[model samples]
Target chain A: MSAKPYNLTYPQLGNYDIPIGFLVRKGLGLAYTSPPPMTKQTIELGAKHSPDYVCAPFKCMMGCYIEAMEKGANVIIQTGGTCRLGYYGELHEQILKDLGYDFKIMNLTLAQYGGIMGILGGIKKYAPKRKWSQIAKVIPTVAKMIKSIDKVEDYMRKNMGFEDIPGSFEKIYKHFLSKLRQAETTKDVEELYHLTMRSFSRLPVHKPDDPVRVGIIGEYFTIMDPFSNHEIEKKIAMMGAEVHRWMDLSHSVLSCPDDNALDMLRSYAKYDLKRFPSSIWVDSQRKKIKKYVSEDMGASSVATIAMADHYAASGFDGLVHVKSFGCTPEMDAIPVLHNISADYKIPILYLSYDTQSSDTGIETRAEAFYDMISMRKEARQS
Target chain B: MKKAYLGIDIGSISTKGVIIDEEHNILASVYLWTEGNPLGASKKVIQELASQIDLDEWTVVAAGTTGSARKLVGAMCNASIVKNEITAHAVGTTTLHPDVRTILEIGGQDSKIICVEDGVAVDYAMNTLCAAGTGSFLTSQARRLGVDVEEFGKIALGSKNPTPIAARCTVFAESDLVHKIQMGHKKEDIIAGLCNAVANNYLNNIGKGKKILPPIVFQGGVSKNEGVVRAFADSLGEEIIVDENGHLMGCYGAAILAHGSGIEKPFSFDVADMEFVTREVICENCPNHCEIICVYRDGELIDSWGNRCERGVIRS
Candidate 1:
């Protein structure tokens, strides 16, 4: 078969810079595009054309796919999932084909065929020029780059508030990403990692004696997307508090399964709450984190309560809970959060976001919440 | 001195505000139509709340804002805590009915289903995109029928043999209603069918994929309609409870959040007197032209956000 040059497009979640950057470094794909940001036009188009009563995210993705196809994207790379999203790829492909868009779709998530060879085979279908050995050579380097990116983000989450100058971590983080994209070897990756970590460590900073720390608890998609929650964590952190967010794709898919069994055992022993049966391992880990960690485990109900309890126990003075407009897991957690708020006597802020593109309203509320918590803290001290 | 807490809830249709004591007792509450101006309506609600409470006797210490406009009103009131309507409503309703398992909230523009497990919201869904299930759709239909919106429930309840109206989208429902009237169907029967349509629309849309258990609380503006309430009760085969203060749940939750915040500071009614304006500008950076909004407080730029890029950081 003749080699056909293709560009891949993935669904937009958080910042696509790192993922896009990773793809570029490997030279597997010529170019990539993140789905267009959800806007009024996007929603209107999606709702008008999509099947009535489908989940909002489905319509959103469909809208993005249609727009991307119009923008001259030839090949789309979709991941498989356990949820309804997994089935969406096939339907989307069919719809796009019906619309007469000539393109190739690379679905990474095939059923239960778990192995690196499968993934390699899938990619090779589009890029037949690259040998398996050549692709294998880039894996370790790509893994190192991912590690470096996660480490920088982890450090920034904890110490970003303490920086003497605002935007210091952000500046260094940008440079770190640039360096990671340019690195061709493990040694280069290691050098850049150390330099980024050193800059993060040495950045001018002062730790507050008792800052108003808050943990962000929410659904996976809304929590990761800054636009959805109006960049709430950053807003709360800007109020001079260390913000902790434990939910991410890396944590949920990569780390949570191993920690789940241990967490379940801890929960059964401590809380005697045998409620979580969805995933025994996840429940147990949630329990252990709730009991042992200073912050919440970032599950559905447990995430909110843990955040509330930690804020109060740590004397952080406040908590902020955010979710998509209609997320199910969070709806179940709100009442328990009420009792925790009452018992701990720490203020909690709740925000539900839809597709509205206005941030003026969000900023105003965050500012007011900060002012209230700060004044309350000052009053208690006085 | 007795300390007071302020709570504000801004929804698509209305803005509500409430002042409560440390014991969670409501001192003053105000509800008014939003009129497409959340900023103005919130200011009015706060001013009215301030007028009811003695500024000297009770010091407004901690404040909270919730609902759709929580962020905007929270900023206007300088709230200590700003939360979502789910948390706010769950907190507010649970305080009144500790065993509430389900919360059905239908407002002018949207509807939501919040599932509570052990006094906490665990699962929830909201319908903002579809108009068929919300109160605004009902109100517009009531106007077309030349029936008073307030009497919708009574008329619905009076029906003996309800006529079937095509109740899917607002357009289809309107045409169906017109057809039913031309066929000489009784007004009360048509009204009853409209109520059923509302309930059916909600169940299929917002209530989809939810295992709705009861000790359910029906809230928001539409809860006032007895016919719609009966339809929900009939459809679910469970009794629906509508609190007298259900419309104020968002504000009530905000008050409770503020009171529990443990802040002690005096509030100034000067918030109502302050001038705030929002200006929207499009970002020219890259292909995505993001419209950024800048909020100015008394000629000083308090905050600016909207552009995905740093191009629109500076304002002229």
Candidate 2:
């Protein structure tokens, strides 16, 4: 007999929700509720229950869980990360239970579960009657799907600022997301990725002969999630500059060198990199980064500094570092980033978001930063 | 006829304005206390600037605005460029002093330092959550000391031996100043010490990690104080260039940017007489309950903001 139909939901981390929901519904035979897109109410609800000092993401997650629970989601799937988010499962579970919401926590603690397959085993346990072969094939497909979703968005970032039509990029992007949700198999997803790329390239663009390229390196959650960072990557692109961001769900899930040939990642670095501070260092700076920050600074924290160093040496005009307020890993990584910024002589703009500051403040800073780099680039060329 | 561009910087403590010609030369300038009403202060500034310029001989082709209430006043004046004070200050300073590498700006409510490389600001740091070393702090201290804040620089200049005051925070500085006064320290010495404290606090916080170099341009309301300028000079071991029009730099920069943007929308001085109204609306269409702000010009809606999503978009 088939197991009871499980109602599941996951936190909003950018538009990855499209692929993630498909993985649950089509891959695992579970019904998923896309909790109302995280709004002011969602954050407020989460902030009310969360501890005063926990990072914004934790509270945001709490709010998402509560909203999903109210909408009849019986199980919550949480993709754990390197920092405090790993332990958020236990605390969030207790908070929800205290509020009397019946749900199962599919907290994929990658370390404790013994890598990706072990987490798959945890998911398999929920539907023991299902055939193992079918579920096993779906795991890699889900990973490929996420990689594909990130790949198309990656290309979109570079040229969205130069779209001939003002809202062309967003229109194509929203359409791609809906098409991605309708994708049934790994083959279908792979086709969608290429098709999306060709469509983006065909769009009318008016890029300058030499565009200003900026690297965005920061905390994983804030960088990946647009709502938290005020759609920063998009905003930067809209300012008539190309943005290169390395942190995303695909990079985190599949490890460095996104198994999918992401053209954007190729120029970033050229090495087989593990999660930790593997040898993906920019040329002639391996020794400095090793000495700049030691191990135990966390993976992304280590990667952020390395990326900054790499992007700086690669002649990028500027770097933007975005982090959620009270993010421990980024807090440790900031000073190191400053040193790299100074040493490389590349301008870096630091943005810390806690949900209270107005969007105009961020926009002003971004506009100023854009002008700085754009001016610097023109001056150098002259 | 020479086309003129107008720029206004409406800060929490003061409203500053400048009307510049096509050459970026300041033709008309005015500074007025905001008195907690930005709209009213901006109107007064417009009237003052309008009177200074021959309206019949010149036309304000475009306008720009900067500072805390840049958007509010930008809407009021139909600004073509609405930029931040940091960028405006950098642009304004660099235009006047091209070789300047460091800019230390302390305004009424906040302090920020911009490090320039090749006439473009590369890095900047603002006092994120501090109010210790700012104009308002010094003004409050001056009020407590029973001295006109305008005379603080002259008095501080007379003191050779400055008293030491703990100015890491306002509360600590207030108590320390009281104690120093009780200890029979001369008034000028204490005033001089307050200047030193302001400079020290700024360098320690906003200027931390920033390489302070020569050709430093100091602009803002705080830069008007000779005592603070001397304090900065002594601390950095370099002369501080305090522009005579430093108070109008933000607005000056805004005006320059408006001219550079090449978007010439005619600005009429009659905005000072026109009625602008704003109202707040609680959007309850969803659970978000976003507080939407609607701007009206002559009883018709012009703009609305504060919604997070398209659902909150007002049909004005």
Candidate 3:
């Protein structure tokens, strides 16, 4: 008799599901259930179950998992991060168990720490017949898919304001993303990427001789997800400005292993000085942030400020720093952002997002910020 | 015929309207309480302003709207421009006081600070989330202190040693004020302390890290309070320039924006009595369930909003 097929689901974060769904279906040969698009009810459900002041992303993810469970998702998968997000899988399992959800959890963070061999072993449990060579072959292909996806999106970000037709770019972009979903092989994805790029290039773009350039840097999840920050990038682009976004799944998650290699070496030198001296573990990210902040401000604090400093020096007209409300790491980055803004003579707008329904206040502030930057740009040109 | 421009500022607490000509001369102005009905208050404001001006000699060719309800009133008045309070206030103040560098405005429910450079607003912050040290905070405390809010400012100036109150939460400040009263602090001192607390709170929150350069021109509903003005001057160590027409700046700025929009549309005073209606409908197309709000004039739907996706949008 055939064993039960593993039906898995992961929390929705921007366009990440496309890659994740591919991974589960093609690599593990298992079912990948797509979590429903986030809505008011999703937020409400998440907020109701989550601890007060536990940060917005946590609650939002909780709501996503619960919805996935309802749709026959028997295995919930989540990635780990250095922030509070690292322990989300454990806490979420406990909560779902308490809610009487009969499901297994596969946290990829441990696999991430153990490297490719660990990931192959984890997948072998689900696809018991699959060989290690087959799993190893899919990793590079998935990495390429991620890079191609981000490239298409990056092009859209730079050109959203310049579309000749009101929404011609967005119309074509949706078509492109849909086509991307249909690509089943590396050759298919690479060909589609080139084809979409060529198709997008043909669209008329009426970018002015000099348009305002704005860079956005913030919490990884908030910057990447549209629902969390109220589609701020779109709003800024609508004001006839080119937006330069700093985070991508390829860079943040896929490339992070290489990015943190230098950090790991530094932590090894100061090994025993760690808070958990009894354990044989050292936090690499905590040591890397010492370059920006003398002390560890906790969870991705260094990256947030580093982005601010990098963007300001790049001479972007303005910067928008957004984060989930009650996020301690982003809160710690605020003072440093102020110093960066003042030093570089650049303007910055700090937005702390909660589950607030109205976008009126946010719209007003963005419009004003756009006006200020454009006026400054015009004055410089004159 | 002289072409006049109309500007209306519809705040949560009050509705302000002004009519100005090409020479920047205010021909008519009116301020009235919104009373939770912005449309009605705006209509009343229009009626009052229309009565003050000679309609036969001057025709309003362009109109603008500002403040929290700018969009709602802008749709009602067929305004050429709908500006946020920050832009409206900055434009109005700079036009009146060209060399101004900073603007400290405290409205009924919200307060804002605008740091200006070369007559342009460089940065601005609005405290819409908190009400611990706003105009309404002072007003409610005045009622509890048994001193008329309008006259509270004058009485505050009499105190030599002002009492200290927490400048954080409005609830905490209120409780602290009550405690101070029980502790036998003089009424004038307590009032003076309240003014200082408001100024300090603004500086701490809205004006944080912003270079508060002079000449600082203070405006808005709370700028009418001389005691708060004095408190700001003492704290910043700079003289505060309170415009005589401070409260009407939003309306004036809106009028200026309308004139600059370069789109000429003749506005008639008769729109004040026109019937306007709004309805909310839930779209059943998708699971998103977006509630679309549509505005109608004379039973004809003109505009609608509140759809997250394009499938739910009903374009007129």
Candidate 4:
């Protein structure tokens, strides 16, 4: 007989838990597991086996899927999107199958057929033991869990740096995650969410009589994925400065397209006087969709520039722009960034990430840059 | 007043410096191993250059820095201009050879091909991803063959019939060299084969799909290897120019850039006496803990970086 219960695994994206939770409550799985975090080794392994010169994210996901297989995940779930990521599930499945791995790939994304019913059917195939009635009973709980996690994270990000004490957010965030993991009922999940939000709200923040604030701008995946960008926010915060980042998923989905365009315009205006210049164009529609669907997908040049302007106006210290290697949008955005860096006299540190094992060289470079900016700030103050 | 400019190029494997007079003629030049400590290496380079020149005849009006550690070394020396190797090399080469159409630089760690027209670089490609065609490759192969790297060129020149070795990647090249050696290939022939392999690898990787024209000046640490220079000449079917000051091109370019920057204030050599140290702090911004580095001089931070964001600016 097949295993009585199983956990479902999916590659990470913006707020993936909500969808995973939704599927699990519908009686398909016991726990929703995110693939292991992407790392240098992950990228290296992925690139070694993957087709040469594909986008970096493709290699990253390939690595994540291969790693998950190694972890004894029997069934894999993949979400379909407009970008090439939508088709990645099929390719990943085929590659893994050729390697003689025994697993089922549940692809929710269908190029020809797409709807709520379609996704439900896909989940049902993997979760054969769960009755449809039982599956129906769990959806609300999963939705609540997702909402709770996203809300708490959003609140923490905006206020974490301003906390009166160091490690306060971290302390509460750990408790929050543990509670989230153990949450059995919708009410329990809701209660945990409220507590986390409260802790976030209560974080002691003094309006810096003269705060050095910085905006972090970059590609969505690298910007949001701490591993990819090298924990730039923490470094910036440790510098006794406030930090701002505007590339969250909630902002992308809830906000209208016009708002995104307007935001882009506001940021671009700083460097170029012309409004809404279409700088980069990819021939691949799937690539474009991948960028559009994710809030900070591709190179988040506009968001970074806008946030940098905001931080600069707010008397922030500097800006940091991070991108994966060979991100074209960022390459196009750099000239404008140079102009903004000069115009505001705000130092901007640009970091490009690849799958190299060594972090020593990167650390040395960062140390020197921080010292230079800090010295400048001190010089001005004295 | 005879004005002079100082340019320093601190790379991963070597440190180079050049002192240039008002006319951009090298007054003093020095090259040494970076020895894993850029600050110390730079200080030594500065002292060596100082000892070689008359301080009264030339006052350093500005200082420039270029290379991977340019920023750190630039900060240490109060550089008027800190540019990337590409810009620095282009400027330096264009100044020395006004009609140069291409600049090929294969250094210890990296290789670059610059397409120049009208004394300005139009396009360029740099190979930081591979180690097959760089000076490090030759150094490793020299170690394997029990030959000193300094004698690599002379040994290659002695080869009458160089063996044909695979030149695609380092692993394949090593295997091919081993196979050829087992087949009773002469040491000189193997050395020549290795030189040719490096040239072929560079042409296939960095020089692919580019218009490589003559008036080509080869520069960088690897340019000192006459075997590789000869290999390049044979591969391209053209005579390659290797200047006596080729290895100093990066520093020369930086110095030229510094002079033309229009910064009139004289540079002081007081940096040699200052004590600088690098400190690292873990940035707990998110799950990816980035170790931000900060450089301090006499207990005061001069610069910090290594963060993906502007988060590690905490100064006491």
Candidate 5:
């Protein structure tokens, strides 16, 4: 309508941007640009324009959107979430427009959209040149790419500390990420995943039997984005502990529901892509971890609490709870986390992030935590 | 030759050094103001400690460093073990008071509460993004009160009724203090109120939800203030143990860690005379602009850190 081609972009969240970019370029047949990796300047730029009391993730995404716009992105897509994130789209659009930037926003959670079909229609309206058949063809490949990245990262978090050669795991991980960006087919992704996995296994490691295990759980965004949380998972792992994190695109979106439910959704979508039943999710995950979290506390609270309890029950030596400052959903999960810590007699290190650039305080707390847990483990063994 | 371990704690306000024998008995110790020069302060500390100990009778084997500038001082001293202040405080307090159930420490720029179980730190927390309830706050308040910091405790004890002051933030507390002074509140009462404000702030912030049991050991620079000690005792309704050597605990813990590390690196008092300089370089290669620190000893680059990536690393 504006006589300009659609160049789509989304805020960066770890390397998941790769899959998102792939979907936009290959599925929607639209021009896409991934924002440059987050830097201190980006956060500062974001914080400068954002409201002072908003959580850090909002500032981070605001920064990302501005950066993407600078790279010629004309259409920005913001997905719906169960938190303040649901309202961020309109706010971001308003602020950017006020700043005199001209761009179209595809906000999925805009109440006027009639649900899943309405969401699909919005996408179709924006990507009028592409057929539904062509878009459907890329969905499976996108799913596979996300699962592969999550799998590789999961393994890397658990084994990076013990690599016989320092930086061996990181080196392979970097290579895999580059190869993943070039993948044009599902087979290419599968090959790269397997190759990276094999290289990881082949790398010699000096891990002791029953090494200290630490689980990371908290707000969805800050926990997954390394820069947001100061690469805390890697920091803890490098301190001679195996780190476990379960919040990612793979776990949260792709593989959450059972296969049967997924198949049912697929059949409904195939019936002319007219329906997407939210009830099919059915809170099965909640029923499974009802002891720890009965009612949904909103956003990622249920997932955070359930995973914390699971990690504690499974004999994790420690837990690290990372959240952005003033994150209501994660803040609500603290009392529950305390109970879990008491029940399992495990220590939990609580880290809250703001826009401050210095990490000296974080480093001190992390080091002290590691020392306490390792000492506790040794005392138990003796 | 008798073997001894040396530990140094270079904090923002003060520098502390201690030399201990195999049995954990202190051979010599020194405490001095840091004066915004950790290297210079630590050098003076080392010289004073060396003068107190007979060099011929005891040979220092392992050295350790802790506190804010642990790494900088550790590199200078060739310390075999470098540890954070929390761990050092826990180990030192637990070693001294084996039954210490909780350790409440208020330092120059930060405060922390460590919950101990069976002489081991089970859980701990430090002040985040705030310095309202720490030693520097009290010193600044002391200057405003026109009283010596050393005499603050005695003056506070003389108050029959302590004034209630805001303790949520340093900025807020400063304005509140000025307001109270304008309202003609007794000086002793105001000072006592400031002490109470600190204790309450610490309890609500750093010690929130922490199980503070009996046999609590209060340490750090603030522990020297009887006003704060009294405030804490009144609030927790428990006996707070303040050791004479509490200020030296961090260094003492470092010494113990070095001794237990079982790696002996010979130490000499002569290192104190060598030139130590630290240079901060801001990496311009990336937007992160990480501040890389380079430590030099006698004009030779010995250690460098604070770089977050390969691009920021300076090839000395």
Candidate 6:
């Protein structure tokens, strides 16, 4: 246990921070401070402290940790993953300590915990004053909040472009998020979710019957975080295309994998003993893209390929494969993406982002891609 | 009076302009270096184009803009359409060569490959996170060799045995070129090798997994280099077509688009005489620090952009 009163913070990943903060404050009985909203300065700070060759997500997280510490957070949490992300916790701790920050790193990767119970116990150690029953009471609300956030965003991505009033959907979305931040119970989240959905539907939209649809699939972190990917989803959606993305906390983590598929996928992992997170989704996705990939390509490659193939087969006009620069797992999936693009005859824009702040290149490419797809659609119809 | 449409492609290294009459016939064209001044370069292009065409006979009704400075130039010209270079090039090339299946473009600092099917672009890829295998690289290498960039093609054609240079990155290729120079390789051979390196790098990077079928059209500033053309031909084992007006294709397409758009925003050569200026204001409202660009004409703000939020809006 930390000697100081626990004030917790985690790296930002889109709006997922809201639910995480809810959990830490309500469930764990610890003071939770949401990391400062990401900006150019955050990225610059992160990049300055990070190793030159490390993936961009590491740099982003590093920046968040420093800012959170400066904002009075003494406990930082880092999660484990299958890729280099699995080792980020230790490195972040070492680096932060070297920088002379007095903080406790609740490195989940180093915790001798296995699955659901393990995660609970690991977090329980910091909230010694709070009973397990009290913590258990808040889990449902946290889960509901995550699902509601994803649901609202999915609708926004699909319909934001077509709204009659330019910023109508965005205004509602912002309101929902602000209201969500103040919600205290499951009923509050449920009511806010229903009200937001209703408001979204009531907004006047000029959607076409056969609108241009673009699917986005890529590395988990970069794909989810709008800041990291330069708000690509919003950019494309605003360009009058319906954007669909299947990789999210709800799909990848909240949903349980089938036990049978878990057994099959475990053998594919080098260490068969570790609990397979989201194995069912990966296994199902792997099955769909079996011809393109023979086995697991590691990290989120399976989800990326499977979602891409799904989008292509379902008659999507375009696909965007986004990844941070020097991301090996996503890089390995490029050959498979190429094959899918060929087989489906769908155009895929490969966007690899580094720490460079200039968005001109991204805008140019995205505009061109939108033009090409919309023109192709017109030609097909004519 | 004959009605014409104007198009301008203001790129990083060069600015090209074209005026086309009905039926997409080129009435006048101009090409010049941007020299880090898009506004100045575009003004000069317009002036040169105006000099070539008789304003008394033909009235330019609509204008379009393309390339990196499309928005800036578009706003300045009151353009009917401002399209990206990829689509503009594809449309222009496909209009000229209806059967063209591939369009290869290597501009000053960027390169892209657009795959066409039935006269429409179906797939495309641009060089990402790198400016390698582009025209500016070749120009720099030409300067280092103490040779005019325009003479590179003819000199490369003279080399029987081209020295092999690294094709992966600009830095690697530079070091390799220096090493071969120290190793006593001939200038012509090294130049030829650099041309080949560009073609190979383009193929390995932008052209990766893209189908480069027949009726391929190679255009852009670099396309004028016969060495790169030859190199592309050799690497792909396919005949590459370079049009006489390939460099003007972006502007030509823009003109076509403006004409097709049916929205007439009267274009006048008087824009060349107008004082247009742009100022960059770094918004200190928040941490994003968006560099909002405000465009002015005769010292009055006309259009402003680059602000991501309402807080950064610059009111004139």
Give TM-scores of the second chain, every candidate: 0.92, 0.95, 0.95, 0.96, 0.97, 0.97
Ten-residue stretch with the least lDDT total in model 1 chain B: B121-130
| lDDT, candidate 3, A1-382, per-residue tens | 1245779998888877888888888887789898898887788888888888888898889889999889878888876666777778788888888888888888766524365457546657777887767766777668878888888888888898888788887887788778878878889888888988898899998888767998888786888888888899999998899998757776554443324657545444443311212111224333443445676565556666766777788788899888898778788888887888788888888888887767888898898888888877776778
Off by over 4 Å in 1: A1-136, A143-173, A190-382, B116-122, B165-179, B208-214, B283-290, B302-316
What lDDT would each prediction earn against the true structure? Answer: 0.71, 0.83, 0.82, 0.71, 0.89, 0.90
Judging by lDDT against the true structure, name the best candidate.
6
Query: Candidate 6: misplaced stretches above 4 Å?
Result: A1-3, A110-118, A256-277
- Write down the RMSD of candidate 6 (Cα, Å): 2.4
- Model 3 chain B: ten consecutive residues of lowest lDDT: B123-132
Find the 10 residues in a row with the least total lDDT in model 4 chain A. Answer: A273-282
Clashing residue pair totals per candidate (backbone < 3 A): 34, 0, 1, 35, 0, 0
Q: Kindly report which residue pairs in candidate 3 clash with one another.
A: B132-B170
Tens digit of lDDT per residue, candidate 4, span A208-239? 66655567777666776665555666655654
Give me the chain B TM-score of candidate 4.
0.96
Judging by TM-score, tell me the better candidate of 2 and 3. 3
Candidate 3: regions farther than 4 A off: A1-4, A110-124, A256-292
Residue A20 shift from truth in candidate 5, angstroms = 0.3
Give per-model TM-scores: 0.63, 0.89, 0.92, 0.59, 0.95, 0.96
TM-score between candidate 5 and the true structure: 0.95
Model 1: what is its DockQ? Answer: 0.06
2 against 4, candidate with superior DockQ = 2
Name every residue pair that clashes in candidate 5. none
Model 2 over residues A1-382: C-alpha lDDT tens digits?
Answer: 1234678899887887777787777667778998778888888899999898888888888988898878878889876655777778889988888887778888777554775568768888776667777666677768877888788788888999999998887887887888877888888878888888878888999999889999999887788888888888888889999999887776654554423446326624543222322323222233347868656466468668878987898988889998888788888888888798889888888888875535777887788888888877877889
Query: iRMS of every model, one decimal?
Result: 9.5, 1.8, 1.8, 10.6, 0.9, 0.7
Q: Residue B91 deviation, candidate 5, in Å?
A: 1.2
User: Which ranking of candidates, highest lDDT first?
Assistant: 6, 5, 2, 3, 4, 1
Give Cα distance to truth, residue B244, candidate 3, Å: 2.0
Indicate the residue-level lDDT of A94 in model 2: 88
- Over 4 Å off in model 4, which ranges? A1-10, A13-59, A62-76, A79-105, A109-120, A123-354, A357-382, B262-266
List A-chain TM-scores for all predictions: 0.74, 0.88, 0.87, 0.70, 0.94, 0.94
Q: Work out candidate 4's RMSD over C-alphas.
A: 11.5
